[model samples]
Target: MRLMPRSLFGRLLAVATLATLAALLLASVAIGHVLERFVMRGFDDRLDAQTMVLARAVDARGRFDTTRAIDLPGFDEAGSGWIWQVRSADGQVWRNGAEALPVPASRADAPPPPPPGMASERARDRDRSHPGEGRDRTGQRQHFRTLTLMRVGGPVAITASGPRRVVEAPLREAMLPLLGSLALLGIGLAAATLVQLRIGLRPLRTLQAALGNVIAGRQHHVPTDLPVELAPLAHELNTLIDQNAEGLAHARRHVANLAHGLKTPLAGLGLELADRDPDGRLAAMLADIDRRVSHHLRRARAAMPGAPGRGAIPLAPAIGDLVDVLRRVHADRPIAVDVAVDGVTVGVDAQDLDEMLGNLLDNAWRYAATAIGIAAVVDAGKAVITIDDDGPGLDANQRAEALVPGRRLDEAGPGHGFGLPITQELAELNGGGLVLGSSPTLGGLRATLTLPL
Candidate 1:
């Protein structure tokens, strides 16, 4: 128990365990005090009994007729601090010349001492014997008690006093076993606390394993045998995976339908135009159909942005990779790219962002004249990526039309009228947009894509 517990269960159980230890320690100390008083009082009772036994020995003669010195009971001043004194009827003392006892106070309504055979009395010690009669009280005394008895002559008082060090000696020897057992219990409690923490955290580890399986594309749903507190999170993850599968299947079906619908019509019209005005009109329509087909195909390639598997892709590294790949493709032209983006990371589907930037960089390489420059900067509230090339720029009207399907800046290629439109659609997919602007560095067409932070 320091400021912080080492583990979760340790912190929880330490509160109860430490509290119980403190309460038990307090009770033990209190009981130890009471027991010390009781043991000292038991010793005083013996002294009272001895004084009465000597008083009964006297007859009507009132004579000191003890047989031997060793016959006196409790008269040995040996262990247990035992002592005794015997007095006669006229305040005269006998047997073991002893010090005067420190007399005690009594209640006004207290009963007087009875006859010698059944006599008993108790009292607390008073200050002194009439001001100055050789008093002695030191030695850091533990417990003190006084006893009085009545006889045929005068009252005889018996008193007992000792330092607590004598009683504490035996008590400490007895408490050793109990304290050792409690120490062992404290150690056992610590071990139990660690075991409890491991058992309690098992559910979290199982949930993580289920997520790992889903990420590796092994299963669509997680098992339901989870703890009650963690069941909601498991249910939500399973439902999300199911929804993503259904949506992707539907999108694939849509792409197939579009491809089939356009392919059949273009083939039929091409055969009929073989005998009429066959001046590439059927070919142009076929090309437009192909462009439209490719546009929908790229849509299927874009990521499902709602899925949770997308990790943070560093914008700078992604841009650099795309630029390097395009550089090898356009090695014939000395196209130079200047990158100035920093450590800004954006939340994007990894494959989707790669495809978007790849297409944009390829487009710039194809149309650039002397130099193609790539610049990325945070502008206003978005990631503004400007790909500029020093080539013949598009006019205002063509710039607007080039972003749509079946439109291109230069009208000559295998898969024509589809690159810019596909790039535009991808830009808007992940909460971003594509813009047609004049390049500040190259004085040509600049494809500016703004992704919100």
Candidate 2:
């Protein structure tokens, strides 16, 4: 379908190379034409000189002196394909040597005098294959260039002729090296253009890589160390990133304030209901309302959309803090919390990361028999943190239901089953995910969290 390339590099290279080739082609043609013209002019000069010599050597008595030392070697040699002819008023034509060429018929007894210099006088014959020159060395019919000069005193004309191929032979020989040089020049120009394109576009490539780092949460903003032409673009992108971060932060704060402000009102309403309704007829309704309010409040506190361009926070310290707090809370249970996390970073807000791990670790401590194992590492450009506990782990169905909000497996349990669901939500908000499976090493339920590296 499309003949041209789509990339900027391809299109630019193609256009530059084509332009270079066209320029070289035009220069070659112009130079070649000029060379051929110059050669033809030189041929005409020789014919003019010979005609002048012949006209001066002859006398007004219409007699050529053979004893005179005329240095016209071409005319002196028979069958040389270079000849001279003289015409007089009596319709008589005298040729110096005519072993190979015919004497052309005269149109009139006496011809008009030629111009002062040797002039281009067209002969009656138009064919290029002269009888004097049947064919040249290449077997092509040899053409001739003739010049005529007339003496002013008497009705006399002198014409000198030379082969046309002499003028063109030198031009043909000169073209080979000329065209080779131009071809080499075109190649050199193409290479230079490629280097120029790479150097010119390097700034754009750097900008693209910097943007990718920002998007992946590895850097805070585009680097300002760019060319003058691209510096404005980097500044604009940094401004936009700052604007988006401000907007998200404002929205989160508003939600948190709203949730906290509603808590007192909900509590007062519950007190008023308890004082008014003594029969507990609305007990279930009040419980549901309280649960919904608490859930909304919890979500408001935990809703962190992970900061843009934040480097991954270290995982070992966060996991250790959560494990230490949980161990103290369940000290009487004799639970051993083993933490193996080291040098791993998670791309999430520090508070949100703590909340997610705290929920998982606390839930594990509740059901663990004796031990809990926590480890984290980087895998496939993601931070994978796994927590395993030797507890009465949930089966497949229960694991699936545990992520549902407020879905508790045991109605008589010590705590509400909102931990896993809250952790899942926090993970999702921070561009991470949570998965639950049986722990192969700990012989209990395993929780795996995957987040951006």
Candidate 3:
């Protein structure tokens, strides 16, 4: 239902095509009119010559001379659709062929003559039928283009006429080539418009590609070395990017400073509580407060904009290092760690990727009974990393609640319950996601991490 295109390129092309078609149509009309007039003028010239020849047969006394008249082809032939007439001042009429040529009643009533030595006054009779004289073989009224001349020395008028087809046929023949040439010119113009659009819009396409690189963290800013029209836009975009980066860095520094300042006081309180309380309840509350503060600060930092020009980090090395560390951390348990990762890479910072994977691996290490499986694959431009533990896994509701900060299913575990939440936040901040499910291979928990590749 839409009549116009939405994209800039599409809209430009559409406008160009419509404009080209309109111009071609106007040219066709204007050129056709000019060609028609040219043909008609040539036809009238022939009629003028015939009228002058027939006028020569009349003398100064306004008397017709039949023997002196020349017999032109299609002029004296009957039903030829070409005819001539001469009217004398004495009201005598003379004509060629059996057709009665229509003439004005008097010399004064006739069309005015042309300039001296030029063609005569011309008129077109389009619809009048002269009985059997001017009718075609099918009895249809024949049309004619007539030229009338008034001799200078006599009150005599000579008129010459030919069928309308005499002018139309040649015009039609000339138009075939004209129309064909115009059609070819139209096609050429259309192709040129398309080429012009593509060349003119190349800068826009380049700007789009540059913007994409900036968004993908491959470039720090849009390049300003563009066409004059787009250069200012690119400069403004780079300025905006720099401003945002500075603001994010300032906010992150403020959050980190505040968290560090809180940590010192929390540590002092922990020492004070350790001496005053034996049950350790106060110390535990202080520790929980410190953990919450640390969690929020970490989450805030993760949620901030990532640095530009961060290339893709290889998945295999990151996963391998995390798995090795986990194996050592859980050395007491006879856990078997199996890693099946590919050469796929993820568009996440190396430190962020390590943090997210380390958290997931540590959680799996704590809960895994005998074996842990870590695997990764590339799917739909994303790297999917799944960590499975062969331990008791949470049900549907527990799995959902486990993602919430400080929500631990088992109190026996030695965790502040911030690991899964931190991992999920980091994953999302890196344009990826983390989902918990029942492990199909290990029959326990499955932590699937999806990151851009």
Candidate 4:
């Protein structure tokens, strides 16, 4: 039902065909008009000549007769292709071979009529008044011409007619040649238009290849070798990628700087406190400083590299390492640390995986009275890691509070509790997140990290 073609090639060809057809049709009409006019003019001239000769044959006495006909070369009675009517001095009229005869009438010329008595000059003047005279009323009529001439002061008039067949017959005969030429011309135009469309779209083909190379990882930037129109687009795309790289580099630099600025001061405070005293305010302050230092240091050490992440870290080894470290740290009691991993990996930095599991393990150790557990595996297209403790689980409010940084279950309350905060921050930086829930393994609080691979 759609008139327009879907493809550019079809549309272009259709447009070309329409244009050529219209031009060919118009040329046919114009050429037909010109040839028809030319032939009709020649026929009118001949008709006018006959009318003049007959008009002159009538003297001032109004005496003329066309029955025996006037003699002239190429104007024979048998096949002259001319017809005539003569109204003589006796008012007797005679008609000839044509189906219809034209009436003779003189029109008033704006410039002025020809000299009153000159037959040569006056004939052309007389013919102009009857331009449509000999044409037939039938729809399929052939072309014809007529000329009428009147004598100065007599009742005699001569009218002549001819089957413009001499002109029209040749015109009809010319149809095939003209049509053939137009067809050839249309074919040539179509060929030229096709070449033009291909040439015009050549640059687009080059651009497509360039984009393919980039997508295939064969190139980092769009190709610079392009026509003028495409040059600006390529330049803009290259600039955008460069700017994005610059922004990532800057953010990484800032994160590193923030971590460095805080760590140096904490180390100085730790050394100073260890030198002071035991069983005093210095001891409590030392503990707080250690917790603060560990919290910030954990975050700083866990920060991933500045470069774009490429490979995923397998969750199994990463979680096992965290559980191993926790068992050592909480070795004073009969703390049991367990790990379950099913070979699933998450797309993240290695240190980021370590940091997320490390935080959950540390939190479990600090809160557990009997047992601590860790488990990680991939599920539903993502990596899920959970840590549990046997200590009394947090209520709704404490569970909510525990997820926040430095919010703890200890009577002293968790301050400088970087475990949950670092875990959540590292998860987010690696395009993942941390969730807080109740534990089934340790019957206490559970910390879960889920990351996309």
Candidate 5:
């Protein structure tokens, strides 16, 4: 049920064409009316002049003078289709051209109204066809232009008339070129409309192409040399792209610093554990070695860049896989991981999503007493994934402290307290963030991760 076109160009072209055609149609009607009036005015003027000629020939004695009245060349012909008539209270007389046509009976009595008013009345003419042609002797009907007047001494009706073809033929001839000119004008208007539309919309089209280039990774920023109307938009887009790039570069540098800072400790641990010592101090050192390595590895994973074409990870399967692994890991605890994720997909790299979800689920398994719940949905063009656990959740103060990079609230717990910070960093890298709150349903901590769609 779409009546109008969808594209801007199509809609604009259609509207412009319709408007132009409508204007042309209206103008044609007005011009045709004016032309008809002009042709008729000229015809009536000629008839009036001839009528005055016939009137002037009559003297003060009211005598019809054939010698003087017949001086006009058309009057001398027998069937030229031009004819005249005169009428008064004393008498009425008329003359025909070479056609030898009779005067219309109504003309003498009433003069058939004034000139042009009687123009539609058909006059008779001889048929040019042979007897075998099956044509009428009176020939085709033709209209005339008749004029009537009254003299001082007597009522004089003088009509100089001709066939309709004589009047219309000239009008038709003139119209051929007029119509041709109007057609050219219409075509010119159409071309101008298209050119105006293209020039007016060129900046918007260029902006669209530039955006496509950025999305396709062909360009890092939109071009800035645009019209004043579009310049701000391009500048803002470039600024956004530069900001994202800077943030990504900063994250990469932080990860590199983490790796470099931990290198010496890792090397020393490797040497101590290489002796294969069986003492309690050696076991504690081994535990510390595992914690440090796992924390730094999670940080590095979280810092990885989210590039284009690095496929989005479906929230349901990713959370489900992590939940299944954690369930097995904590079999003795009897933790119930309930997943309620539908068709939500997060715009994050698959490996990054896995590392973030793995750390979060593992943290929940260590803390949760029995039941854990996971759910996801799409809202406002973003993916919202929430995980809830039924356990002794941390307070506001503890929650804030736990998000710090290396803050451990529960040192006795089987984690290095890097899960929330790593997950937060990973979410941000994917144009999203993480939130910690109280779960109303599970009466425990609720971890909400919001990522771009």
Candidate 6:
């Protein structure tokens, strides 16, 4: 149902090819007509010359003198398709070849002969020289291109004719080369059109590459030095990017201001309740409020756009630093840490990476019995990092509940249930995700983090 192509290049090429073929066809028709006329005119001129020679043999009294005419090739031979005849008003006829020329039904019906000394003038008019059908001595019909000339003062009409092939054979021969040259010309035009399309569309490909760089955070704006036709589009795209970044920054400033205002009062309330509250019920409530405020503040910072044109950060060094700090914090407990991350990188900010990994590693260290395993690999264009502990792991339902914000499954731990939720939010903001499952190797909780490469 689709007659046209979906791509711009395909559509342009199709139109060019059709136009070239049509122009070549029209040229062939025009050239063939002109060449046919040239060949036919030359054939008729030769016949007219032979007619003049035969006319000189006729006398003024309607008599044709046989000896006065010069002998020409194919004229005097038997069965030759070339023939000349002079017919007088008294019914006396003279011919050079053995075949008799077919006579008209009436002398009055014949076309008027050319006037004396005007044979060359008459040759210019194609209506005067025409083709006729005649019979040979064997009674077979033959086609001939004939010309008739008459004496000015006598009733004698002289005619000379040759086979129609004299006009047609040369045209056929000339056509072979003409057709070949036109074919070559068409091929050349098609090749030229292809090259022109590629060169003309190169700017579009460049524009696409520039847009991709912006999306990958490798550039802040598209290049403006483009063709006149595409300059407006690139300018509009850069304007839109600036608008979005400004809006995100304004929202982040508002969130930071609100979090700071709440933290001051919450800190003052915690100190006031230290002596008045012995059960510590009000103190726990104040601590929960502080944790929520800090969670939102960190989330707002994570949601802010990253530095323009930022590059990927190496994962191994960040992991090593976090593990060393966690070991120092939990130095009283005996734990074994195995790290296998090397030569791997992730397209997330260094601070966000440290926060996400620090949360997961701290949890692993807290719940780990004696050993913890940390490894990373690239999978399907993403970096996958797994941290496993060799302690009691939660079931499927418990694992799902642990990711919920402010929902703590274990009361014995010293957390307000904000760590895993904060980690998951930061991972998602940087185009990554976190999932918790049972570790097949350590037989404990496995925290898998995936981030763009």
Show where candidate 1 strays beyond 4 Å: 1-10, 13-75, 78-81, 85-136, 150-156, 215-218, 227-453
> How does candidate 3 score on lDDT?
0.76
Which portions of model 2 show Cα errors greater than 4 Å? 60-80, 99-145, 152-157, 269-380, 383-450
Candidate 6, superposed: residue stretches over 4 Å from native: 58-65, 69-71, 74-80, 86-94, 100-128, 131-159, 257-376, 379-450
Residue-level lDDT tens digits of model 1 in 1-453: 578689755576778577757866776677667766676556545544554555455554444446532334434554333434444457665544343333323342222343544433222221111111111233233333433444345445333433345556777775677567666776676677667767888888788788877764456688778888888888988889889878867877677677767777767877777777558776776677776666555445443345344367778889888877877877787787777777666655666677678878887888888788777777765678888888787878878988879776676744577777877776776667788878877988898887655
Q: TM-scores, in order shown? A: 0.47, 0.57, 0.65, 0.49, 0.48, 0.61
Instruction: Give the better candidate number (5 or 6) by TM-score.
Output: 6
Model 1 is weakest, by summed lDDT over 10 consecutive residues, at: 126-135
TM-score of 4: 0.49
lDDT of 3 by residue, 241-284 (tens): 99987987887788877987898899888887877988888888
lDDT of 2 by residue, 86-108 (tens): 56545567666553323333323
Count of clashing residue pairs in every prediction: 1, 0, 0, 0, 7, 0
Rank ordering of all candidates by TM-score, starting from the highest? 3, 6, 2, 4, 5, 1
- For model 5, how does the per-residue alpha-carbon lDDT over 1-453 read when each residue is reduced to its tens digit? 997999988899999999998998898788888987898777656555666677677665555576677535554566665566655537756565334333343434333333333323312111110000111136633334344343345434455654556667887888789889889999999999999999989999999999887865567789999999889999999999999879867866786677667767777876777668756687577667656556555555554566235466778777777777777877788887788887887777676788778877877788888888988888877888888999888889988998999899988867777888989987876667898888899898888888887
**Inter-residue clash pairs, candidate 4:** none
lDDT of the candidates, in the order given: 0.63, 0.72, 0.76, 0.66, 0.71, 0.80
TM-score: model 3 vs. ground truth: 0.65
Reference-based TM-score, model 2: 0.57
Tell me model 5's lDDT, rounded to 2 decimals.
0.71
Supply the TM-score for candidate 5.
Answer: 0.48
lDDT of 2: 0.72
Q: Which residue pairs come into collision in candidate 2?
A: none
